[model samples]
Target: MKQYTIGKKAAVIVLHQLCMILMVTGVFATGYAFRHDAHENIDIYTLISLAGLVGSFVSLAYMANVAGRKSEDDYTIYYLPIDKVYSDVMLVIFTLLMVFMGKVISGVKNQHFDYASLIMTAGTFTFLFDMAFIILYQSIVRKIKGNILCTHSLMYKGYELLKRVIEKKDIHTQKTKEIMRIQEALEAISEGALDTTLNVNEFHGQQKKVAEAVNHIRQGLMSSVNESLKNEKLKADLITNVSHDIKTPLTSIVNYVDLLKRENLENENAKYYIHVLEEKSQRLKQLTEDLVETSKITSGNVKLNMQKLDLVELLYQTGGEFNERFESRNLTIVTKIPSEQIFIYADGRQLYRSIENLYTNAAKYALENTRVYVELEKADTKAVFTIKNVSKNELDIVSNGNVDLTERFVRGERSRTTEGSGLGLSIAKNLTHLMGGKFEIKVDGDLFIATITYNII
Candidate 1:
């Protein structure tokens, strides 16, 4: 079963219950003072103080409950009239009953029913005020069904203010700037906004401004993402056209070279030249295929057939495939596998390619004879796959310093000098995302680590 910590929520609930009691007591005191004669010197102001204290406490409870509800419940359910409001209404009724009793007591004490009508009126007024708020909230959103949800929904008023700025704007220019500012403020607030308290008027004003700013920023980001997608399509098309043009002639050239060798051009000098040409041609073909596949992945045209697979087995198979390649560079693959089958959901082929890229990348750029460490583990309901390799040079890509360090083809300053198309990590990153996981690369000194995590439970 899903569960939530009852620490703060339980506290608020207790506070709310206490406030309800105080509110009822305050109502009775106020009514008693109203029914009393002016000459009695009954010190009616004392009742007023109790009422003030009760109202203040209740208001705090309401605010805290609202904040708690918003955190745990869906925004759409926030406007729903829940049991908490009904419970509050019930308390108001109890307050009215107590006030009526207080009136009778005061009347008996003062030996007069002269202020009876006034006491009843005061009781009626307090009851109506509490009931009206309870009824009015029902006309909006419903909150989630749980103690936690009820508490957070109390902040719906603040959320609604922000929602308005985003949806009900007229002038795009003013609205856009406001939305941007709101987003900035929200970012700051998320960083520490709740800790800093402010009055309703000041807080709501700031909230509206932040909401407007956020709306503008959201629209702008969406537009930018669309443009980036279009540009990627264009890049893919260019690569496609270029590949066709280059491969057609190369295919014929290779066929003609074979024919030449068949015609006794296999002499020492002729064979040496032919071998060089064949190697260069094969290298170009391999590079072209990599470019095409990488482009397809980037343009979001490739689909992966995913399934549940054993993580340790997959890693072992991938390492074996690259063993011959890495052996030439004196690179070693050191793996630390637990004696248990770690299962994960992913496309086996894509996962293989991703890991292969990491190993090959290490072989190409890592220091000779260095071991590339591969480890698998299950922690916190996630399957973690980590690959660590040596870095020969400093990485030089600056993607606005996002710090996740997995933004596509970013290589170390030293690795950039090696022969690579720089699309290996980018493809791996996208593949991880498609597989419902995260891919992250971190650089520490001479070591570069690629980590992938997927939820297994």
Candidate 2:
């Protein structure tokens, strides 16, 4: 389809040009024949020849106009037409007429007949030739306009490649303004001074002025965005640090308050209230700290500092920390960790916190008299840590895993009724991620399991 359109446009342009050239030559030939009067009884042939030339030139003008339209529509600019039938016909007709006009003109000039009629005929033919050339010129001008429009379209579509070119123009404009301003300032300073001698005061004033002018526009845009994130991150880190730091003292205070209330120094129910206050206070402090830490990890402020450590040793130590709570509720703590160490690179302290949170969650929410299983194993390049305990019932929906648990004041449906900060797993998740590990939860039947894994770096 493209080839055909191209060929057609080329044919029109070539034939038009050829017809124009022939028409011009025929005009000259007709003038010469009319002058010489070479043929007798040539008036009819001369008139026909003149008409044929006029016709061919008119066709040429029409064809050129079509070529301009096609070029405007981007039909073709590279192909040439092959047909020369119209051009050949015009050439033959004009050649014969030129011969007849020459004979007639020569005869009239040599006194075979009066030249008045030939003169009038020549005037008419000249007028037709001028009209044809005018139309041909208009067509060329239209084609030029078409070419320019097409070139503009091509440049507009190539925006990406020429993007820098436009930007440079804008940059140049800005620079020109700056240069003008500087030049004005310099002129003012020079005018104020009588001599070319440099003055320290003026020099300092100019330097300060330039500095003030060239200051960053509202600081670096990228830096401003980065700082906002850092500020948010700093606030979160502060909350976590403050919460965790205060928890130990707050827990001790709660314990002491309960001890005082239980000694019967006041109303009997006072002891119960003190216990409740202690429980609630401890939960709040722990939760605040956990949420802060969670924010820090999620916001990408925390970095992993993994070190090779024994999985078996870590799990055992973490489980032992929850021994008192388990014993108090007649719950059994089961271990599936091998005696041999499973070494993996992870932040030991953070990993410890993760384990402790898992165990604490189990002890707080697991069914009474049920066994809690803790397992640690090395699989490929990762160390998998699993803590599972029997739940009271199947939860309607699984927990939103670590994210919701980490949110400030958020709690699980069934476990909100129990004693908890609701930030344990959230903290655990943060710690796991900090150690370059992943944390996840799964529930099967009546068992709720929290798992964390670290790559064996």
Off by over 4 Å in 2: 1-266, 291-305, 393-410
- Tens-digit lDDT string for candidate 2 (256-287): 87677657656758767777877777766656
Taking all chains together, each candidate's TM-score versus the true structure is: 0.50, 0.43
- Give the distance in Å from residue 345's predicted Cα in candidate 2 to where it truly belongs: 1.5
The model with the greatest lDDT is 1
lDDT of 1 by residue, 1-457 (tens): 2222456545554454444444554455544566654434344545555665676466554544453244544332343434455434444555776677567545544554345554454445544444443333322223333333334443655566677875665335554655455555557655744332222233345566555555565556657767987898898899877987888887887787777667776479888888777767766776677777777777777888989988888878887888887788788888887877888888998888877778777877877778878888888899888988876665553323444444544555534642665667877888788888898888776678888898874
Worst ten in a row by lDDT for model 1: 194-203
The C-alpha local distance difference test score for the whole of candidate 1 amounts to 0.64
lDDT of each prediction vs. the true structure? Answer: 0.64, 0.61
Could you tell me the lDDT of residue 140 within candidate 1?
Answer: 23
The residue-level lDDT of candidate 1 at 316 comes to 80
Off by over 4 Å in 1: 1-225, 254-272, 392-418
